[model samples]
Target: MKTDLNIINICLSDTPMQEFIRENRILGRIISAIPEIPFEKVKIGECIRKGREDLLYENKKTGAKHTKITIEEKCVYVSKVLKKVAEEHNSDFLILDGFLHYFNGAYWEKIDESVASDCISMAAEKAGFLPVEAQQENNKKKLLRQFIADYKCPPIQTKDDDLSISVNLRNGTLKYNNGEFTLRDFQKEDMLRYQLSFDYDPDATCPQFDEFLDYVLPEKQAQDVLMEMIGYCFIPTRKLKLERSMMLYGEGANGKGVIYELVKEILGKEHVTGFSMAALSFDANTRAQLSGKLLNYSSELGGKCNPDMIKKLISGEDVEVKTLYKDVWTMQDYTCKFMFNTNSLPKETEANVAFFRRWIILPFDVTIAKEKRDKKLPDKLKKELSGIFNRVISGIKRLLEREDFTESELVNRTLEEYKIRSNTVLFWVKKEGWFAVVPPENTERKSAKVPHVELDFLYEKYVAFCKKKGMHETSNATFNERIRKLFYVQTGSTNNATWVFCDKPKEKDIPVSDDTQSPKSYVERFIDNLNEEK
Candidate 1:
């Protein structure tokens, strides 16, 4: 993946402070508080040349026409202003508008971009511009984070915080607007698309709402998935990575396509991506297409799906992405969340914790009968696109309020399935009357075809089991290594060694099922007995 230096919180002492802004009292109060920060004073009059401005927060002071501070100033002025407002108001959070005016990058060459961003965050945290709930290490980081979380100062433009979606957060609700879908600047050459006069409500609905919901997908999870997709649609900034990917699995004639269309319509074709699951691992060019996307809705998946590649994509780790016409591969953190429609789960996966953690399976077990299928349902749902979009926006607010994603029964079931699939060895051992491995003191061995077990014989059973399940067979070496790692299970060639199988916890002991659940609940799964490749 091609990586961009998006956001960092490293404080730099040598960040230049020589550039002086045209003196203004506001700037004076701000700069005096943080002398290391530097900025040039820009008034509303200077911005009047554009003939139009979208920053609602940038209101001009009446009868105030200030002189221009023309010195080459560092972009750290944003941090200074945040510090001033925070200290004066004793506020825990400050609006994002004030910093947009100082995003001028003329001094970018003179300042370290990462250090500059941190300085801003530090100033904000010190000034108490960050919410109390947010983690705090220092002032500059908190302020910079506040900017990233609620950066609205665009049309309010800044290269430092370039994002497609414009977020207007009030109270707990965030009004996500600006479907223009491209960052714009005053310079004519930098423009990608014309700023259209769009007045559509994000919460708009289509005409065929009831039939689409009732006749199409009756499952509650289907609705939750659609609403969550809509919530994700409004957020284009990839600051907070989505750790889990959505999978819509069921038989044909279900309402998968309609849900996909609703999300595609609202987020626009430019931001959503579609590809077969197999391409994710092998096709560099295909994966390249997903570079700047916000969501990947995969429909047709080929037989061979690489779990490792999918794991990397969903985990928000560094990935190597290929761009067409570019010879060398670039590394980027592809934070786009994925949702795939498949008839059945892949027969095989790495079955490791890394893979399971990133996969959220929503089984469309309920298939809409052919008799109940509505041919015009897509068109009807299309009519209520506005309404569907509105529901999604509302969903995002709920997600923000809740902040917990793994609260579904389907998630629990999917995790259970992952457990069984990952530990194919354990599953097979239990299925057969294999020699049982108990604590060293407790001697018990379930009778099976072989009275005495050897490392090779146990591996033979594992190989046959994998073939029976249509899964790739793990090597004997790997199997024996896993046995050694699992404390309960011991494997060796010695004649005295016991041919015992380690018992897996019953369904009641499942990790996610515990009544008491929190972030720590996820850690319930200990390091598995399977030997993990570090």
Candidate 2:
């Protein structure tokens, strides 16, 4: 009963020959009965089948026959077959964190456990380990468990350098350095785990995308900013070291939704995650969802926004994330950029300079008429993905050169307006015209006389404004502190009453500054004067 020893040799490669034979007495007995011969010339299955027939017995009374190939024996046989199959394709499989990953030519792709098990079973079946008709599924499952236990390995540790430098496109790998982009074919050494859904076609034209941008953004500067942002989303943002979240804000029927959908399509669904402001602020599980993602976005942003959490996410700080059914782990240097579209801003208890500076609010003011709205605009934009990718590349080039997003007039104006609107005290002060700038008596003087607003008068106005706007007015001490910090104004005691030395609010809009290209609000000019004096 000669048999091929190749399968046994491969399966027991890791185990001692004596140990394997002792563990499986039936297979060992069949192998021991074989005559010494070249391993490749004999078939082990034929020898095992011949030996199996000798172990069969018939029930004399009922005429029923039973074979000695028990369920346990079948599982053991199938597991050995699986081991042979696994050894043959060892380079094709990787176990990371107990998850099986299969190399699919270009990169290692994670495969579901059930899928891997099915594949292993199919391989075993092909190798002549036919499943018994009575307990095929149960037997197969047991075999898969045994195979996994024998195939365990330490997870491969992924590093930041492995994922950050190269952008994986469907066609190739794209790398950028010092304003230059190099595109090359994918290599196994690149170690990329994910890839963009679209091909990298440099000559692709996206006229529909161009038209969509023009229709939505209207201003060329805003369009450029959007393009740059989309490009920024294409790469790992932590490399840029810019910590800013973008908000597309306006009423309904605007183009914010269209832009969001287009960006998602270009980046692929797997690379982007959607989380509401409320979820991100309060849910630790939501933070875990950001792992391995390039962008985190939401269409509806509402409820209270936690400044501390928002800052941590945008600034690439370490955050604690507890994955479902896993131990708590810290996600360090998180690079996912936050982008959201909202009709109303989220409520923040403390909206300060540091918090406001991290946000870029782009106003979507244009509302397309219902009759003129294109129902198939998203479908049309999908056709131009490759061309749109080119536009994104152009933006990436410009962003790398500038080292920042395009500073548009619309963006600045919208941001400043949001800052003021979000702060009740500042909004009240701006709207009520309480603070005004006083001119210097000497034209050559660097500092101007700072006008004072009576504290009692200011507090009264603030309380009334809060009441009218349905806002909760802070205590007198808190109000005073916010005014001093936000306005950068001083306080003075005059005639037993406190006075805020913030200049009176300007009556008319000042002309745009030559250097800034934007008009300075009275509070800004006052802050500038205060800084000059210091």
**Per-candidate count of clashing residue pairs (backbone under 3 Å):** 35, 6
lDDT value, residue 392 of candidate 1: 62
Superposing all C-alpha atoms, what RMSD in Å does each candidate have to the true structure? Answer: 18.0, 11.7
Q: How many clashing residue pairs, candidate 1?
A: 35
- TM-score of decoy 1: 0.54
lDDT of each: 0.50, 0.66
Minimum summed lDDT over a 10-residue window in model 2 is located at 439-448
lDDT of 2 by residue, 1-534 (tens): 124687655643422433443343333333233222222212344445577545556679997554444545555555555444433442245554345655455655666655555555544444445433212577557766666675556344456555446678888888876566688877555555568888888788988777767876888888888888777775565557677788899997888888889889988878789998778878888888786677887888867767788788888788887767668777765557889999977546434667777788889998887886987899888888888988888887887778888879999888766766766776777677554333212232122244466777888989998999887787888788666643434333546566554444255664433322121355465344333441
lDDT tens readout by residue for model 1, 1-534:
123332222222222421222132333344346433222224334345655333213328674444443211222345445644534632212222122223221110111334435445444333333322112344434445445444333232434355433422111122233422222222221211111112235545554775666555565655665577556534443533456677776777677776667666656565678887788888877876675466788776676878888877776566676555546465454446788887777656644666666666766555777777777766666556556655665666555556535266665666676566566654555455232333323334444442344556677778987888777776776676554433234444256564634333345344532322322211222233322433
TM-score of each: 0.54, 0.69
Query: Which candidate number has the best lDDT?
Result: 2
